[model samples]
Structure formats: C-alpha cells, structure tokens
Target: MSCVFLALKIGKVNWQPKLNKAAHHTSDYCSTEVILRRGQPFNISLNLKTTTQSWDNFTFIASTGPSPAESQQTKAIFSLSEEGASGWSATQEPSEPRCLSFTILSPADAVIGRYKLQLQVLAGNKSSSKVLGQFVLLFNPWCPGMF
Candidate 1:
C-alpha cells in the first residue's frame, strides 16, 4: 500500500472570489489574478506549516507604487488584533488549526495599483517575514461616501 499527502507551505495563502461576482459575464476576459476594490472587504486564508503560539504576533503589510513608503501613504502596516481607520486593516476570522483567516479592508482613498502583501510573524526576539502575494486595487466608485 502507498500513502500520499499534499503539503502546503507555511506562508502559502489562498484568496477567495477569484472571479468578480457581478462581472461574471466578463470572466473570460478578466485575468486570473486577485483584483479588489478600495473600501471593500476581502477574505484570505493562510496555511501554516507549523502551529502558532499564543505569544506569536502577526502583522500584515500592504504596499503599492514603485516606491512604497509609510510617510508617502503608499504603505500600510496592521496587526491581527486591531484594525486601522486611515489605511489598510486586517481582522482575524475563525479557522481550523494550522490555518489563519482574515478579512482585509482597504481605505477608500488608497492608491489604485498593484499592491504587494507581506506577513511578519514575531515570536519573542525572533521575527520572520514572508511575501504572501500581490493584488490589484481599483477605485470603488460605487462605494458609499466615494464621489
């Protein structure tokens, strides 16, 4: 007898809504990439190869533009416990063991472009960072408060 199992890496991320809900008619032309709208919330699930400790602090980083800088408002850094009001925010959702799920939201005034996402895990004095992936954020004209 032979046994085989598929393994997922620690930093591997799986995003939902690969196809736009309302844009189903254009699915054929739409690129198979993560495309999001500003001011709207999206879901992402990350698979961890190892179990996380209670003391582990997780931080998410989202940046856009050629030069992404915090001072320039092109970068956003948020944590798992709290959500930001002026920029990007990530809220943890219930999930199974060895998996982390989050509901992420971007400010309406965020820059429209391809944004790179990274995750930083801090466990006491040891810290590690990984580039999760990138997504395209477009202007949310239909969102309330947006002109």
Candidate 2:
C-alpha cells in the first residue's frame, strides 16, 4: 500500500495535494494530518525550485517522542537507498523534472507516535534542511506477523 504525501516546494510554492486513503488505510482518520502504519511503505512528492543535480544528496529524518533521540529508537535517519543504518528507508520513484517522488518504509518495530519529518539536502559543500511536516505512525494491525 502506497499513500501520497506532498511536502513543501523549495521556493515559491504550488500546492497540489492528493492523499490516497485506501493505500495508507487512513480513510478512517478524522484529522488533516497524515497517518501511516509501521512496516509499511508510503509515497511523498516534492517540487524543487531548481533541478536536482547528480551530486545532490537527499536525506530524510523521522523523529518521534518528546526527546526524539536516536539512541532511544525514537528517531530514524534514512536516505534514497534502503541500505541505510537506520531501519527506515526511502527509494526514489519515477517523477517529472524538478519534481521528486519517493517510496518510504518504516521499520516494523518503529515507535508508534507522532513523527516530525525533515528533509536534508547536501549540495556540494553546503547543506540545508527543512521541516517537511508531521505524521502519525501506528502499529500495523493488518500485518499477520505484527503481534
């Protein structure tokens, strides 16, 4: 199941939001925020002000809990590849120019709570990060092995 989440555009913004409730099993949510399940994959799209270069590096950070410390398992740092040290991962999906899409997956044992998502971009020697948004992650009741 893959749900769509649109983050901020770098410069002037153009919002075109589309949330797939059926894919994320979030049809029952009453709030405006995104709701996801552990051990599942979701989709996110971003529109950048400038075209991305081959040297550009993107990293995602998802943090939950009050302290949100990495050692406490309340935070996860992942990238465009699934081989990250963090259990969470994001893979690039085919997208249009200056527009990027990703399929993100959280670990099955991730802490269940509200999470703040941030995107960090490393371009050459300079690095900047932006807070994309927040979302709620719940235990996967549908997963047969997720007891």
Candidate 3:
C-alpha cells in the first residue's frame, strides 16, 4: 500500500504596508514597522501568492486605532480598493502572484499608533485570515520653527 498525503498551501505576505524596513523593529510581530504620516496618502500594493486553491472572494481590512491582537475593540480603517493592481478583488485571483494596491487616506484627525492588518481569503465556505500583525502608524509633526 502506498501512502499519499496531499499537502496544503498557504498565502504569502509581500511588500511592507508601512513601506519601511527598519532593522530590529519587531513591534507587530510579523513584518517591519509601517510608518504612516499624518494626512498623507498611503498607497501600497498588497501582493499575495496562493499555493493551493483559487480565491472566490477576497477582502482586506485595516485598523483605525491601535489595538492588540485577538482583541474585540478593533476599528475598521478602510477596505482595499479593487482599482488597478491586476484587479484581484473583482475575480477569483488565480494561483499566480496576486496584486491588490490599497490606498489608505490617513484622516487629519487620525490617531497615531500601531494598527493591525488583516486579510480575508475565501474559497466558498472555507476562509482564512492572514493576519500580518500590527504596524506602527506614525504621526510626526515637524515644523521649521525657532528652537
């Protein structure tokens, strides 16, 4: 008798959402710290790769405020737009490299803190949350004034 064990595939996280690769920066516990300036346009591409099955529906949600993982007090910042970036949100993204560019417009009154990022991939009834942990949303105010 031969044993046949079919291995399953998982999704991969590509590109830094915060768009910075700082050394020894382990705040979110996954990728590097993401620096988001206040009232700035955060346009980033969320590149993903599926190994096994095709995606039927995909959704990406970000945090509006800083919160710990598995906490029920997480606020939804915004959903990733399906505009451009290979149109991964409109169709079942194949097993190739899927690209979904998300533009997070940081409100002027937005809180500056570490926010978590969650990606939901669904194939029929089965779904998975590829939580990339938290990234630092920095709000720096530097003005050239007299010291």
Candidate with maximal lDDT = 1
lDDT of each: 0.74, 0.73, 0.44
Candidate 2 is scored at a TM of: 0.81
Error of 3 at 18 (Å): 9.6
TM-score of each: 0.81, 0.81, 0.47
Q: By lDDT, is 1 or 3 better?
A: 1
- What shift in Å separates residue 118 of candidate 1 from its native position after superposition? 0.3
Worst 10 residues of 3 by lDDT: 1-10
CA error at residue 74 for candidate 1, angstroms: 0.9
Write the residue-wise lDDT of candidate 3 on 19-134 in tens digits. Answer: 43332132354543565554444444444443233333556555654443324434552334443332112222223344544454444444557766666665545655667555
Q: Which stretches in model 2 have alpha-carbon errors above 4 Å?
A: 1-20, 82-86
Rank by TM-score (best first):
2, 1, 3
Candidate 2, 10-72: lDDT as tens digits: 653221224445666778878777888888777777777767554337888999988989999
State the displacement of the C-alpha of residue 2, model 3, in Å, after optimal TM-score superposition.
Answer: 27
Better of 2 and 3 by lDDT: 2
lDDT of 3: 0.44
